[model samples]
Target: MASADSLSKLLRCPETRQELRPLDDSKLDELNEAIRAGELHNHAGDEVEQTLDAGLIREDDAVVYPIRDGVPNLLIDDRIPLKDSD
Candidate 1:
């Protein structure tokens, strides 16, 4: 997992170009649960099948970038689009 300070300095939303913050624990857990259930999807409609070890949420909360093995996967096509209810 990437440290909050490092991630804040290095990550941004690929689509929105918004700054990213480390996802809070509760939100991370919720997202992980959704991923585990195969319920998470990206903006391009691709299913997210991998468990999220860490994540960064866009400043506007519109998307989440998964951090795997301490690296932020900021690819536009891999970003998880956040719904109003998520």
Candidate 2:
């Protein structure tokens, strides 16, 4: 995975065209846990069934683009939208 500093400098959200920041460790861990528990979802309201190794959350916290194998999957369809936890 790219270092947080590097990601912050280089990555942007594919959907909103806004800058992205690497999720902090605690937040990353929480998201990963949710992924493992089958709790993650996308904007389309579909469940995210894959593991997120790491991610860059949008500055507005609206969505997260997953990073797999050190590559940020910034495709719009790949974005995981942030949702209120029930």
Considering every candidate listed, which one attains the maximal TM-score?
Answer: 1
* lDDT digits (tens) for residues 1-86 of candidate 1: 99668858776666667789888889889998998998988767888888889888889887888889988888878888786643
How far is each candidate from the true structure, as Cα RMSD in Å? 3.4, 3.7
Predictions in order: lDDT: 0.82, 0.78
Give lDDT: candidate 2, residue 13: 72
Clashing residue pairs, candidate 1? none
Best by lDDT: 1
Off by over 4 Å in 2: 1-8, 84-86
For model 1 the local lDDT of residue 46 reads 84
